[model samples]
Target: MIFFIYQIVTKPLTSKLIRNEACPVCNTQDSLELTLYMRYIAMLIPLFGMGRRTSVICTNCGNVLKNPDSSIFAKKKYSNKVADAVKDIRQNHKRTLWQLVYPWSIWFILPFLILILLGISAINKKNTEEKAKEYAELIMHPQTGDIYKSTWFENGLSQGVLVKLMRINGDTLYVVKTKQKIQMSFSKDEWNKLSADPAAFEAKEYKIKNFSILKETNFGDLFMYNNDENGKQYPIYLGAILNSKCEMDLGFETIERKK
Candidate 1:
């Protein structure tokens, strides 16, 4: 169980030393300094800003005067110099580049991630189209060492199955099914592992009519199914073949290996 952790971080943005200003607590001259702080919320990265706070401190006594006029400076007479200093601090207040950017980080971060996702989706779609074209070309050839990858939709879950062309005898094509059904949404490493080992494939070979069993769908993709009276397609049989590359580097000697 993991959760997103957020934190509130406070950082100093601007600081100004009030010259000739005396600390009311310690009576130390030229000790008062006013600082402006920016508060921001952060996750793994700094997300956005919360608010700001002002603080006044006495350097000699190491005392923090949060409110100058309402606290110790209440009894002291408000001088022209002190009032001008406050105005100067406000006028001179400026934030650094990071301080200005981190507060409104969400404005850019969301758009940046969205652009990345759209780029990835576009690449995947292009790859799928190219693979479909290769499959259409090789599906008609029906050569040995050719592996067909299909998605089996069952119980709202899709599982992947790999069928390999063992041999072709007369009008029948001998094919071997994979022992373990690969997940439709699987990693390349998982597919490579199953295809590498000979034991991962079924020992008994199945036979299907060379051209009769092979049929093209409306989308131009080829698949193996029975063309009986009701055009029955078995769930155990292979569905729409996704990949048509003769040699997928699955430790098989095919057209790619010869090239």
Candidate 2:
């Protein structure tokens, strides 16, 4: 199939005979006829060709001869201008047909372009991972005015809390929402858990009030008054942490959640 192609095929010209002379092979009178056919191969491989062929058939003996040469053939040659014209017609079509199929070579450069695209994709993935690690270091020292956004993660931190610190009292971090003071505390254990997905950490919108921080301790005695939906309060005592920023970098964060 690689040798297949479409092309403009021109018609070949022909002649009747050498006045229907006698056959040289069978010695039959008015039986030998002559013809001139010409064609060339244009595709990768030739399907058919009658390149400069001289065909003769004897009507009386039914003998056929093709491409009979002048030296091997011992018949009286036609000695007129008509015989010379037939030879010229066959020779005109003997040149090369290579120009008809030169465009097929353009399909050879497709594989190199595909490999270049795959190399670019691998480099992009490595850059995204480095950016995620650098972003975690930016929030290492959280201040009272520092604002955080929501965390959208596929891991344990998906749809997590975000808040801006309005006040930091000792180990206590407070944010004001709806004219109410919402206090949060991050113990060593709580900090370790929250910052685990540092890349997904973010600040929350003040109008969005769905967050949770039940088992964290800052104001030691005040945590006793709060709990989950249950009437019990579970507290995680901060282990020698002076500020919420240091606690957050340790992996803990606080969010308000509805019971």
Candidate 2, 185: how far from true, in Å? 30
Model 2 poorest 10 in a row by lDDT: 205-214
Estimate every model's Cα lDDT from 0 to 1: 0.61, 0.40
lDDT of 1 by residue, 1-259 (tens): 9998998887777777788878777888888787777778889777776655556778789876555324433653435666576667756777566666654677778999999999998877776676555555566567887666655454777677666778888766777767777776436565555563567678877666563344452231233335567886542343445434422323322112112
Separate clash counts for every candidate: 0, 14
Q: Give candidate 2's total backbone clashes.
A: 14
Q: Which residue pairs clash in candidate 1?
A: none
Give me the displacement of residue 110 in model 1, in angstroms: 3.1
**Model 2 ranges with Cα > 4 A deviation:** 1-114, 151-163, 169-172, 176-259
Cα lDDT of model 2 overall?
0.40
TM-scores of all candidate predictions against the true structure: 0.53, 0.25
How well does model 1 score by local distance difference test? Answer: 0.61
* Candidate number with greatest TM-score: 1
